[model samples]
Target: MSGHGFHVHGPHDHELEHAASGGGHGDGHGHADGGAASLSGGMSMTSKIAVCTAVIATVGAIFSYMGGSTQANAGLYKNNAAIKKTEASNQWNYFQSKSTKQALAEFARDTATDDVRMQGWQVKLARYEQEKTDIQAAAKKLEAEASQWDAQSEEQMHQHHRWAQATTVLQVSIALAAIALLTKKKWLERAMFGVAAGGLVVGALAAFHI
Candidate 1:
């Protein structure tokens, strides 16, 4: 106690104050380090997710392109089949015209009274028969070609379907990855990887034409 009514702090009071200040500074440093570590971890996870999503999107684009190409090929092949079928029909109609002319020539030859007239009619009938044979052979060949084009069209359509399937699966995987990033769930990340791998397998099947 002082005459002026002011009391100075003792050694025990000073020691207690210093200890309290030191403890507060230490606790602040600890909290700062923990926050920095958490921020670093979050940034790293965000980078990983961004990179993976980019790769998946690229793969899906490739699949979509392949599907388009196959579908276009199918259309072209189908058009070829139609053209061949039309040609076959034209040849068949020509053969029928030749057959009608050959029947009329035979009847003329059978009812002819003069030898010279009958001989001329016989020549005409033989020519008509040979022409009919050639026309029939051409028609059969055209029909066979049309059938082959139809088969090729079917095969291209099937390949297009396979590419479509692969693209769809990869899209689903990308969706899953986005969900995992938003929710920060480890199990969702695992599911995303599994689905992406399955999409790749389906893409392989499409490449091999299976």
Candidate 2:
């Protein structure tokens, strides 16, 4: 084609030339060249999208692992809390038993006519009181420990929630990649990759529990 024709066609060089002159006399060669170029472009795009999808899938897997781990830890903490609470209840019951013994000892001392027997009953009552005090302290310590564990577990589970959100984004990105591949839209592919980046950000935050 002439300079005027080239000027009218745009800067796409060979492609513009082909369209301008309809491949001239070598129409077969021209069409073949165009087809080859189109195939190469398609292959490049497909490879890119496939790689993007694979990366997204990997991120999703990591997020899944974190979520599962955190949830398991949370459950373990809750179990420990329950066990501590039971122990605390048992301690309180023991305290009540000690109080009963103390009351019985007091009554026996009050009724005893013999000085030696009365002194022994009084000593037993004091021992019971000391034991009850010790038991109460231990029960309180156990309850405190249980509460700390429960809070830690809850924090871990909260991190798990963040991981879940990241995983969801990664999955959505994969789906977008699928649609982009089917539609053969480069812009859509780019958008899908952007989503994947966002997923990665969220995943990192989850991993760090931030």
Candidate 3:
């Protein structure tokens, strides 16, 4: 032992050993931090998906409402025009009957009163006919516009619904993936895969409906 100019067990050696043990403890803490970071990352991703689902659902509902409104307006316009046409036709018939009665009652065959009455009746009839035509034309135009609006609205609604459904599926899948990661369950991971596959099929079916 005296032959070695230094002591085998020095204070520095003990200090170095203690520092090495401390470094191992730090390494464990580092691993825990890394795990926590991974969990947080998963949660952030899930939150994003949930937000997207909400947005898509809102859009779908709006489109459905708009389509319904257009259909209702179309029906209203058509009904109103039909009622007006019926009323105008009834008034014209009444006027024609009155004119015939007055003309027959007069003993004079070619009286001015008869001519004036007939002319008046013709003018009323012409006005009624024009009104009827105008009403019918307006009704047709409104109906066509309403139908076009309904078609467009329905298409938008379908698209929105499809997106909403897809978002829901994605949200579920993300939740499942997070659980699988946390619990390290093989079954959950497999189940998540199945859910994702089913979602894709459902989305495809929705697209076909569109």
Residue 132 error, candidate 3, Å: 1.0
Model 2 residue 8 lDDT score = 45
For each candidate in the order shown, give its overall lDDT on alpha carbons: 0.91, 0.88, 0.60
TM-score (C-alpha) between model 3 and the true structure: 0.43
Which prediction has the highest TM-score against the true structure?
1
| Overall local distance difference test of candidate 1 | 0.91
Error of 3 at 209 (Å): 3.5
Tell me which residue pairs clash in candidate 1: none
List, residue by residue over 1-210, the lDDT tens digit for candidate 1: 798899899998887887787954687778999999999998787778778889989999999999999999999999999999999999999999999999999999999999999999999999999999999999999999999999988988898998899899889988988898899887887888888888899989989988
Winner on TM-score between 2 and 3 is 2
Off by over 4 Å in 1: 1-37
In terms of lDDT, the best-performing candidate is 1
Off by over 4 Å in 3: 1-114
Writing each residue's lDDT as its tens digit, candidate 3 over 1-210 gives 658776587888887887787954687789999999999976775565456445534544543454455455555555555565555555556555655554553324334367777566556655655665665566556555655655555655565566456556755765776687677666776676677666566566555655
Give Cα distance to truth, residue 136, candidate 1, Å. Answer: 1.7
How does candidate 2 fare on TM-score?
0.79
> 1-210 in candidate 2: lDDT tens per residue?
585565444657777677678665487787899999999999999998999788789879989998999999988998998889889889989989999999999999999999999999999999999999999998898889889888988888898898899899889889999999999988889889898889889888877879
Ranking of all candidate structures by their lDDT, best first? 1, 2, 3
